[model samples]
Target: MNNPAPGASAPPPAPAARRTIDIVNASLKRRYAREARFRFMGAAAVFLGLLFVGVLFGDIVAKGYTAFAQTYIQVPVYFDSATLDPDGSRDPQVLANADYLGLVKASLRTLFPQVTGRAQQRALYALISAGAPQQLQTMVRQYPSVLGTTRDVWLIAGADVDMLVKGQIDRELPEADRRIKDSTLTLVDQLKTEGRIEQRFNTGFFTNGTSREPELAGIAGALAGTFYTLALTLLLSFPIGVGAALYLQEFAPKNRWTDLIEVNINNLAAVPSIVFGLLGLAVFINVFGVPRSTPLVGALVLALMTLPTIIIASRAALQSVPPSIREAALGVGASPLQTQFHHVLPLALPGIMTGAIIGMARALGESAPLLMIGMIAFIVDIPQGITDSATVLPVQIYLWADSPERGFVERTSAAILVLLGFMVVMNLAAVLLRRRFERRW
Candidate 1:
């Protein structure tokens, strides 16, 4: 190197080169350790979340699994002509009017002859469902020739007795502490020993409607209401959402009015669901005079709530289509409408459907809006149409959760399982549709 002049400053020292891997610096080691710790923390958080989900599902399955089966008793019913059909005509009307309650009580009395006092007899009769009369009526109508005959018939047990037989109500507890009395337990055990009581698949739980009696209650009405509401929601939301998205993304001028509308839609999507319920109450029920608790009102309300979500999703989907597609279509002399309908819309449909599914799923689980419109009421009859009195699955769950009966606890869990099942199916369908139709650019 040449020497510097007296007035000139010496060149600055050169920077140190990076050390080899064989001699790593302490700073590098610290950095690697920090990165490793961060990764572990992230993994731990994810594991904890999954573990919580597993615990929840396991608990629900444990509780609700028993609700799928019911206890039934085989009673020797003597269809005496005097009690069932005094006229001997076996007319269905006569059968409907007959005292089937007397026949059921008589059968139970014969089964336990030792119980004689009025109180004992009352307790014994309480083991069977009060709805047994209706069940007997159905049996008689199905086979009118069975009149004046003695035959064994399977009848449903009462909810308390059902719980005892299902092993839900503990026998070890003191008689006063338990819902089932010692006498009732003895009779249940005797019946079980004789193979007269058995657990069978509970078809009534699916086929019937809400009842004050838990054993007689079912989810058919709520299930039907959910279907009707969803049908209406999809019918109203999909086309309108898609149309609005197409216009805003492709056809509408970029102006303040359009910007304001976009902002409002975004804000609406974030609004609490109950707010929409209140809106529906004011507009559809109070102003338009639509019937309360009807699926029509429910769908209209859900449509308003779901509209913003669908519009946002559809706009995003429409925007994602490559500009090259539009250009190519227009280059071939296709008009704006033709370009959108024939080219862009077809490619964008998969994403649009995914958004629709999400919106529908959100609507399916919403109960607050429906509650505002009176859908939380107990509806015993399966709705024959959208305008009929009805409740949805979420509302059914809410009602059951509020019930004081021990049986409704299991029912509430079962309803939750059912609602989750529906959501899973909807999401799966969306995924399948996307995979089937999505094209690689």
Candidate 2:
């Protein structure tokens, strides 16, 4: 390495070190500007996402919060034995079959004696829900001694009357254009003046089942269906998904077969969810004869849909456990199974749980899958078990949204709010669980 010729003059002596602040190369400046732009764009995207979420939540809450209250009219329901139960025997079946409707009509007529004409009377009768009689029947059945007494009962008003009482219906609208007639609206106002019209917290919305009457419709059955479906989904998916993941990651030999399986699982995660509904219909319902419209079938379908997600997440978690941990455990006389079960698996649990919760949140909002298996049917009874006919909360929302009743609009929104609330709770719970189990090392 002969030194450069003296004429090279030492290549103009090496430039003195410059302060970083002074070294503002154009390329470096451009790169930094690009990074700043990227950060600004990312922040803007996040803000936009948060803004949309807030707006959506605000709209839902505003539309639905009113549904939690129901209007009622306090009317005297005289339990005339002749009108209600001609039979002296107090048989439950006979009592149920009694003319409770007549009693309600009589009570209403007694209050509005001025309402004459058949058409006017019919309109007046429309102010009270047909379900009111059923309410009275339940009341009397609960209090058998009230069979012979005249008692004041707070009865749910009809959809139109309920809307009017809640000020949702415009009384100034033309009688032809309004659901509640002017005469009926006047009577409702009269009842309001009498201190009998009241709005109460809708306990029945949480207690009773669905009904044909919008005023009587409740989400109890749908809530029960969701509970059973989710419980079954979690029970079946967690173990099966985790087991498959473990076998693939920890036990199975690396081969084309395993690779094919992994590919299929990843594909399944992106398949249209409704396709799974169709598969459930063809396989579980048609081929296997599983009862359609039951939570059991819904659970089975959801479990299948959730399996790929859980398996992928669990495998990733298991793989993330440092190989050093496996090597150290094996070097210390620990069996492979012990290494996984006692060490790696425990550390991976938080990730598995996080995935499971996200999967469940997806399942909870799924309606199309449940709809394919006959869960779209209008069910009035709360499901007693997984096999009982039922609809989930999302399906219920769909049903209510399709209903023609003005009241159902609010109900649909309310159900959506409830579903959203449940999702928020599940996400929060997942965060808590992850934090609780997180192992830094």
Candidate 3:
């Protein structure tokens, strides 16, 4: 290069410095723009996810809130001595043999004094649950002395009345086409005015067992059964799952046997839930002679289903623990078990619990396996023990949903809400546990 004249003064160093600054500034701007796009995409994904969840919650609440309200009819029935005790004395056998439907009919007549025709009485009679007669019979058997007295009784009405009171009935429909006649509506209004028919918080929803009639249906039995089954599952699966994970992660020799085990675990995770159910039926029910449809059987099946998930998640969590922590614990003369329990386990606990609970939530919603094990059958009484017959929420919902009656639709939706509530509680518990036990270091 030729030397420039002295006066040229080295073509000002400012231009080259400006070019370098421009290049760096452009590169930073481009990087910042890309970062902003990624952040916006992430925020948009979060918003969409929240929106979907909100819609689902709103729909469930709207459709299922009515299940919490129950309607009851209050009526006074006179127990005539002729039917209850012909001898006019308290005879337990005679009282037991008393006509309960007669009492119900008399009560209905008293409730609707405005109508006297036999056909209308018969029509009004259809508005009472079929089980009401048995209920009255039971009451009389329990209280034999009440035979010759008039007493006020609050009884569950039929599903039609329930639907009407809950606004599920279309009032504009013609009287001939409506399941509930106009006469019943007139009586309902009168009863409403007299405070004899009212809606109250339905303790029955949580206290009573399943029924064919929507008015008599309750999830208490199923709820209890689910609780027992899940409790047992957690008890059995957690220790075993975690212990296996620890051994595999910390001490097991890496060999073909280990590899085969790992592969089997991964394969088991992908197995259909119903397959596990069938296995449980074959092995636990048939081979071992465990009672079918019991909470114990259900819990065992669920534990098997959840094991793979727990193992995989736990191993991942254990592996995520920094090796340096283990080395330090060993440096301080800590046994491997002690180091794992004291240091590594605490760090991995949040992830482990998250996985376990998520797996449990999956188990709670599973109905296919439950169906195979006879959890689909009707359970009129609460289960007394793990060996007792029982059902779960999903099975209850399935049984109800399969009913041909229109009332079961709402019942199914209601059961779904209950199941969803359980799932939400489980997930919330997992989130809380994760936050409460999480270790950043």
Candidate 4:
């Protein structure tokens, strides 16, 4: 209140501005703290997501890597000419139907003469694969000269013995709980010590077909079926989807009908995949009389399921082409068709292909749709053509996962690894193709 000495420095203005500055500084500090907490939470979230992905992949690899190798046992077989060719005719049919299993049993007896009781003998014989006879038949057919020789042939071990060799079976379990008894364990140990048991890279797992026996089961048939189904699905979906999208996006009248179609396509993309399966079952099978469980039927189903996705993606890709490009093309004396085909489509091709590949990848992993078409039937033969009854890889995995055998467990995981590899390859192809096409223009 004192006006004395007006030039006496205005009494320092009560330091009022300092209070406002302090309040602002405190608020800024709190804001900075909140920002740091938010950043920490985001980093933690990203790390948690990555950690979960790593654990899932690691577990799958741990369980599946063991299936790459198969166990085998060496059996000294006296290829009794009387057993292989009882009449010595060496006829193909005669050799085909011979009791090759008897020869395997006789060899097992020679290896372990101590096993006398029929039940004990059966348990000992259980060590070798049931495919041993078929193996012998194949070998004899390949080399007729080996028919009379006594040779030490390495044969696939039974699933149980393979499990025991791989340490999957617990030896400490009681006889009632264990799949194999102490007697079988002793025999397996003896074979192990004698250097007769061997583990080798399993080529058959990639080459053979479905089997009731786990040891003989492989992914070959499923791989073939998957290839055929996907090829046909691509053939059916790509052209049709692209044409439909081209018409609707570039040429079609903007009427209510086209709008309804656009809306329905968007909705179809959201439909459950199983509904497509039911449609295939009713339409492709019931109305058209297409054979069930064939790759042809599966392809039809997958093509239908993938159509909406392809249409949507294609339309988006077409729309992404700049309107200036179309204007320039038309201004340069190009027709509407010429502008779209010669300029717009080529530019949008990479996106279109990327979408197509994504749809195919989805089809590759689908089972419910194929299952509705009866692709779940246990077809043992490798399908040679599209019309042949077949089951794709996903269905094969489903079947194996449902199996009770411990051996099938590993095979199932291994099959999953294969499926994932295929998916990776497909996605990589899409990326590579996109880059390639992008550079073309």
Candidate 5:
């Protein structure tokens, strides 16, 4: 009825003209600018992070590459009756009683009979590992029948000789400044020409344990200890951590006490790892009387450290499961326990595994806690079980890093490489598992 609209109504204020710039600014311009800025910032941050990682990796590789190549000398030595025993009778006890240094000296003397100066011979013998004599004695004792025969043995040389063979030593350095003498280098060159000395991949490196001589050190013992400790940590921490998380998330009453417990768990996760070590020391070591420095103690400490992480992750995963799934199960007359276990738990598994693996990785690289628990000891033998005293990879690295030996620098870097490799593998496993088992519903 009010057809009085038209141009009536006071010449309706001339339709406000829309500004093209305003439309562009309000719709596309602002959004595009904000998105572009956000993207640029994210990309810049990622690039900077990657740059730092690349530099760090490069440094580690540069410093550690030499450790993979080791120098060895193959010496032919004659075990004379005089050295093995004055009487030609091969007594096992006599062989055991033989001096290792005398054997090494005899071997060197036989190799270079023409060079008879005692000091020169001592210098040559110095190239061999101090431990070499003990090893030879063991060999002779093991095979007393080979007492009077010539034996060919591969002996690890001193760190100086190792540095020389590895090309780390500067030939330009003065004899006084250099660890290895010019005479030793000359012998090494001669040995190389004779095919008695060469550089090769150090298989012993992975099998040997910490030694005073870097050239003789291996990570095998530490690696085994780490494996056992981590295995124990996983076995003990995972089920308990996940169980606690599930109960707290799905069954526990929502009350102040529960809230306080949750708060404490979160706080524990943020506690300094060394504090956990101290706790373990007091409880596991002192009160429980679990052997100090044993894998059991170390594993217990790591389990404590990893428990909070697992619990947090598991709770988050369980929380992420849609409530509708549980309701649906219950709607069909399923009990609460059945609904949670059969329907929700499966859905949360992938995230739980990812969290557990990440926690394990963190535990693997932890050194401070292990240090306090006495895992810093020079453990050469692989542990027989969790109760045996042990040292881990990180602690081994720490021990090597603090050594006065020059070759320890490379050993430390090599250990870092190994630790990084473990972390990478764990992360990859977590990613693969999550992708394979993650459920959308």
Candidate 6:
């Protein structure tokens, strides 16, 4: 080492440590700057996602909110006993089969006797929905005394008139470009001026079934199918998924078979949902001969699709039960099965149920798989059992969306709102169930 100068302060040591700290300080500022940028980007991404979701919700609500009500025209019907029962016999079948539509037409003509030409009369008749006949029949059958009297009854208007009343059709557009011609528009306005045409809450929209005519179409069949499919799916998937999870997590010996199953379960969760539809097509529909387009087949397919999620969620819930709980149960002289079932299962039940419900919700929204099983068929009758022909809400929406009618457009949006509402309800249920039964330890 070099000798220090006599009596002089040692030459100032090279400022290495200080220089090193300066370097670090410079890089630290850059690092912090980068981190801030990253946070800003993350927040921006989240904000963009939420913005898009809000826009979508707003659009759906705006289009669908109007479908809850429909336009109707009050017609003075003279239900002549001669037209209903020519022989003067009060036969229910004869009354039921009478030309109720004819009565409605006669009433409209009486109201506008100047509408003489066939074309003008046809336009007048077109103002009323075909469902008016059914409505009249129902009314007459319920009250036999009305068969010979004149009564003003409100009847659902045709799709065109309903749209016009709802202001969905553009008035500024040329009459040639519009479905409602000038003559029809004049008739509609006259009726409106007379205080006979109006809008009311559409009961048939909820109570009726699918129809080629938009005004007569309803979601009752779809709702019933959804209920039946989900019920059967829950029944089949919950017990099977939970039981398998318990067996694998608590009792099964560690081996290659279990490892294979573990990998397969993971793989199945990622499998395209459409594959399950095809599997359902091959196995349930072809091999087992389950009725095509029935809720039974749909339930089987959805159960298969949901099994992986339930199994994974259940296993995770079971593992969450602390090992100490198992040791304590065993220490108290509990058998292995008893330790798992009596002690662990009760604590994990909420998670298992939540997982099952979420899986069912996913199954509820699925349409591709159902389409493969022929659930895309136009099912008009409400399903009463799992074996009955059915169409769920998603499929109903799909069918309606594909229709080339103005009325169906609103109905489609309304159906989507209903579906989103259901999914929200289900997810909320999961949260509530967890909060209700969660054991933090």
Q: How close is every model to the real structure, measured as TM-score?
A: 0.95, 0.92, 0.85, 0.94, 0.89, 0.94
Q: Tens digits of per-residue lDDT for model 1 on 169-190? A: 9888888899988887888889
lDDT of 2 by residue, 1-441 (tens): 123334433344444422222343434657889999999999999999999999998888888888899988899877887766777788888888888888899999988989999999998888788889989999978887888888999988888888777777887888899887777778888998999988999987888788878788899999999999999999999999999999999999999999999999999998888889999999999999999999999999999999999999999999899999899899999999999999899989999999899899999999988888899899999999999999999999999999899898888888898898899999999999999999987
Ranking by lDDT: 4, 6, 1, 2, 5, 3
In angstroms, the error of model 2 at 35 is: 5.2
Residue 428 of model 2 has an lDDT of 100
Decide which is better by lDDT, 2 or 4.
4
Least lDDT summed over 10 consecutive residues: which range in candidate 3?
1-10
Model 4: pairs clashing at backbone N, Cα or C within 3 Å: none
Per-residue lDDT of 349-390 in model 6, one digit per residue for the tens? 888988898799899999999999999999788888888899
For candidate 3, write residues 177-219 as lDDT tens digits.
Answer: 8887788888788878998887778777888899888778889
Give the least accurate 10-residue stretch of model 2, judged by summed lDDT. 17-26
lDDT of 6 at 5: 29
- CA-lDDT, candidates in order: 0.90, 0.88, 0.85, 0.92, 0.86, 0.90
Look at candidate 1 and tell me the lDDT of residue 51: 100
Candidates 2 and 5: which is better by lDDT?
A: 2
Q: Model 4: residues >4 Å from true position, as ranges?
A: 1-25, 439-441
Question: How well does candidate 5 score on lDDT at residue 5?
Answer: 28
**In model 6, what lDDT does residue 288 have?**
92
Clashing pairs in model 2, backbone N/Cα/C closer than 3 A: none
By summed lDDT, which 10 consecutive residues of candidate 1 come out lowest?
14-23
- lDDT agreement of model 5 with the native: 0.86
Q: State model 2's lDDT.
A: 0.88
- Tell me, by lDDT, which candidate is best: 4
